[model samples]
Target: MSAFADDTAKDEWKFTLKNAYINRNFENENLKDTGSWSQAASLFYNSRMVDTPLTITDKPLKIGVDASVQYAVRLSSDKHVADTVLPFDRETQSQAPDYLKHGATLKLGYDKTLLSVGELWLDLPVTAVDASRQLLTSYWGTNLKSQLTDQLYAEIGRVEKVSPRNAEDFQKFSFTSNGKTEYSDGLNYIDLRYQVMPSLKAEYYFGNMQDLYNKHYLGLDHSFNTENFTLGSKFKYFNAKEDGNNFNIDAQNIGLLETLKVNNHTFGLGYQQIIGESAYPLPDGFLPETYFINWNATGFFKKDEKSYHFIYGYNFKDYIPGFNAAVKYVYGDSFKTADGKENNESESNIILNYAFQQPFLKGLALQYIRIDYNVEHGNDFGEDRLFVNYTKRF
Candidate 1:
């Protein structure tokens, strides 16, 4: 026993540590009074994979465990600003001084299939957890993934609860509309993907929230490659409707994107439209993954809205290694509010990113984002965000 313990102590464990600081301010008079200066930290651990005697197709079973914890706080001289920026508990009606999140999961694999149970992250078209904030949202449930053939894949899962990005504990899933919120029993989903050829792929997804709503998604992606440049195109569609005992929900969304990459530069154009009486509905605190081309800080999912966007990006690796920049602009109009008020809006964003190339700081990176937004007859605001990240594995 002593020898075994000594040997184990000599081996390094797999872990990661992350830290971030974020600051945001608004331009509107009503919103300028509140600002945010927040800090966050996270730790993750993954156990070494172990091979077990259980086998399905002459291959040994693999088992593992993963755990993570995240904490965040807001700093400000003004109490009102601090309270407004920090995480808030809707039920408690107060600011949370420190938002702490901890969870664990078990993983099992055999040949072409893998199973995960407990707290986990999901990235499906209709039910993806949002990870753009300080802490990522997570779900409590089970998921199974399998590779059926060389070019076909499938995933099925069920989640009962969720830990929101700003919350400390997991809670039941809920849907809110028109100042009314209703909780659902759970959510079930299935996803399928097939690679028709080397350059074309197709995907389909279906999600149902018990007694709440049902959603369906279909997507197609294709690309053409050449020695000098590459061209790509993507199309996405979504349909959603109410289930039972919920609000009357009927929505449809369609998006198309085209891109061309030449040397170190890329250009993109996109169009998105909403074609129903109701605005697109997503799970509370969740975002669509790769299903919405016009989704940025603000989405163009308003009822009967038509939006168009243009994007330009350049990679400066040859001139200045580890540097890239991009700018995007979107214009949306032809939408009406619930009270029949005409509205139009526009948004522009600038993004810059850099990563350290030196061996001593190989995993360190920095990012900056700027946003300018305007509404024809509503509040207007501008925002800025800076991020620093580092990661190491042992």
Candidate 2:
């Protein structure tokens, strides 16, 4: 008995002493446990990109898989519209083959140190804060994040590719058909975030977007809480340099909200603007993360243009167990356009959602979208989308 006890003590002592003298760097940390897994799928109907001809109706299937080690895969397939034909085709364009994306990753960490390598979807340091679309695709990149303090963190990495389908395993994938231009190697970004107060944060980022251009962003967010109402503001600025002498490309957006609990209705008003080009591009599009809500009308947010948006939501706890619904509206005009000249387009959306108390089924949502465009100003694109989604997470 004494010998067995002595042996156990010796093993514990050895382990404690070994760990005490270990000199481990962040990148050399031993691989530990594998991560979790997540899967999501959705079905939708649209009038534009998904349905090329704008004639025959089509339904698209989109599926996604994400696992530990930052591995992710996305697959998409769709039926063709029977009424529309390509330029040379006498019949409707044949259905395109399913698109696939596969990604993989590895991470090492020690104490407050961290190192990541692989393709994975990340929304830290650089991302839209309130983007909540269930079927929306995510960005992929290899980033290293270090926890500088409890309230601050920093990250830098190369975005080898930007596809929601295959996140981390893009090493052998090439965007160009000829395989000459390696798109992944051409993208890089660095960003930081710090929490000034319990409810305020400041963020900054600098990066280049392959052949498109170079850009930087700065933003500040703050929230104030009182006994009856909560007030907050999101302010941001962007500077982009086009390869050649383009118009001074600069854009900014400011959103302010005030919320009070009176009865069961919540009312909020938002305003967003585009100062430079036709619109500020992040995620390479004009969809501002600020004015993203169903029912808000967003006219083409062009240079010198300002938009006013409004939102209303209601929580019905007694009617459907647990449910909430919202609606929004937006309107805008180009600042530099003459009174008779055409400007950008306008948009509106409405959404309704319900959540269940069951364990497996968390929530379900439905959405309707409408876009009215102005072709006279070279902004002739217009379309509509009807969508419904269900999500379950474990």
Candidate 3:
């Protein structure tokens, strides 16, 4: 069964349980060893999309609510470790407490347009919540989206505060750059997508962080299918500038990715370059969107950096049912440090995933990931992550 209830149903609730284990071994050249291991268990409850009892202008009102709680413990003996291993309470310099997050949203539809308010999980080119960890981020905001025309869609939204993936409470939009922390009152964004043709699409996005920074994105995607294989191409560009005099930031990012798929095997090649004096900046706790092809355990967005990556993936469903594997390798160079020195970095990842197809384990899934990262002038690390998840709808 699907995780969400059928739209025809008046109301429904779903629950999920997940367990995760992560371990990292660091070989630092300048700092002490920061290796650590951690374990976490999370429970999530979500209400299916349902219409409310109220209506406006003959249109039905819709609402949704989602909540999650997580408990994590450090398995390694070290109390001081990287945030990826375990978050620490800054004030007390101790382990962080259990986490709780919840959000509710109401949507009103009119024709081809929809307006949503209250808590939201936004996924835009410029600003998006990060859900790669034990919990996902949520925002207090309002958004409006509309199908402007037959092939064009538009969206505009404003967010006031955010509850970060690792944080327990909501806070103002803030990010740290060049050893300084800058705070923003709020963030506003506009997004547009257009289907140029049957096989091509174009996108544009602009975002402004009040008194902080401004970001603009442009992208194009196209695909071609043939009898033997399918080929896809993606191009993305970003421009970042300081919004006010409070901070100084200027950067641009350009990336291109090409992919080919032949039956169960997929291959990809990508290149990304940063052109400016500063690194590409994002919200402190958020992850890079799809435009950033070189974002992995570490982002290759340093000053004047150029990166190249390759990917290969295989699906075993034809032979081994519900199994898949992938490997990615990235190398980046030509980055300048604060002291005028150049540095380089490399990252490699291997992933294995399986989902049970048997009736008794219908909703069971398992995944394992391994990452190896090395930097010419920084720390090197090897990390492993394992996840066991099960879901049921009632």
Candidate 4:
């Protein structure tokens, strides 16, 4: 039993449990007795498909289904898993346990056009996506995309809040009054993407974050790909205002990357800088992804921030009979109002990720994160995390 099980009144392993139910339902109905369970099984499959991505082929009408389950454990409280000081807890146990972790995405695609609805994992204006650290966060929405002409295309949609593992079995947040309290209302946004040229793409986004935050985003991405080398650059602008308050901010993020691939080995380098104005850092609960990788590193670092990261990975063409290992490192700075004083401080952190890929067993990933923080104007404490997860795809 996990330590959190003893600390909390309810079983914290709901996610794992729900995952079991979903899998068993599929096996028993679809495989055990196809004729008797046809209707029920089809409905179950359709729900899964509604939330998954559909690949576009030559056929306009296409259908497919897929799902995955992830079992994870965190050995340390270091929330942003990296190699750092250990957490203060006597037993850093699993935060979310035995949770049903699966979603199905569907596609209604035609020609160069596609429509997707159901549960989705999104990376939009970069704020919300950057801030979420969990691997699986799903949104209920529809994405309408089109390839207008040969080189131009666009995407648009609206989504609910981020739902992590065990979401189906958990009690979700709701509101009695319109935007009166936190976690009561869902977020809505519009995103646009245009490919101006073969190497460059531009994106614009606008959204209302319930009653707490309103935001705008503009970004440009350029890529250079060749036989053995790839280089990429991204520049983004984020503007946000606190709802029902006299607070607003403007921020800019510039990122550059270069990668060299040799057979099964690859090396890369990256850098990012944030500049803006705000009295204090954004709330820790919102936007955490700007700090780390794994797609869910919520946006916790505040505005007026500057950070850098380095990555190194090598793939063995034929190692361990049929497996490969990859590793990455990230380091950067965070800023916030200094200890309730009328000053601010610059914090630093280091994060790392390692994964082992085996053909039959799929892949197992381990994440270590550490934030060594301090205040230029006062006392300081930091956070550390260690996480391990297993993933299989068919």
Which residue pairs show collisions in model 3?
A: none
User: What overall lDDT goes with each candidate model?
Assistant: 0.77, 0.44, 0.76, 0.44
Q: How close is candidate 2 to the true structure, as a TM-score?
A: 0.61
Error of 2 at 276 (Å): 3.2
Tens digits of lDDT, candidate 4, 181-292: 3442556677777778989988778766565566677777788787876666666556666654433534455455555566676666666556666522243223334422
Which regions of candidate 4 fall more than 4 Å away from where they truly are?
A: 1-107, 126-135, 165-184, 225-229, 242-276, 279-287, 290-300, 308-336, 339-389
lDDT of 1 by residue, 1-394 (tens): 1121121222233333334444445556665333445566777776645667787667677777778887776654433443233565566545566678889989787666778898978887655666555667788889888888889999999988888776778888888899888888888999999999999999999989888889899999999999999999999999989999678889998999999999999999999998886888866654444469757777878889999989999999999899999999999999986678999999999999999999998888888888888888676777776777776766
Candidate 2 C-alpha lDDT tens digits along 52-103: 2222234222111223221112122222322111111227533222223334
Superposing every Cα of model 2 onto the true structure, what RMSD results?
A: 18.5
What is candidate 3's lDDT per residue for 75-153, written digit by digit as tens? 5565554454345666776655444556666655554566778777788764566645555667878898888888999
> What would the C-alpha RMSD of candidate 1 be, to one decimal place?
4.7
Among all candidates shown, the one with the greatest lDDT? 1
- The collision pairs in model 1 are none
Scored by lDDT, model 1 comes in at 0.77
Model 1 TM-score, all chains together: 0.90
Better of 1 and 4 by TM-score: 1
Residue 26 displacement (Å), model 3: 1.2
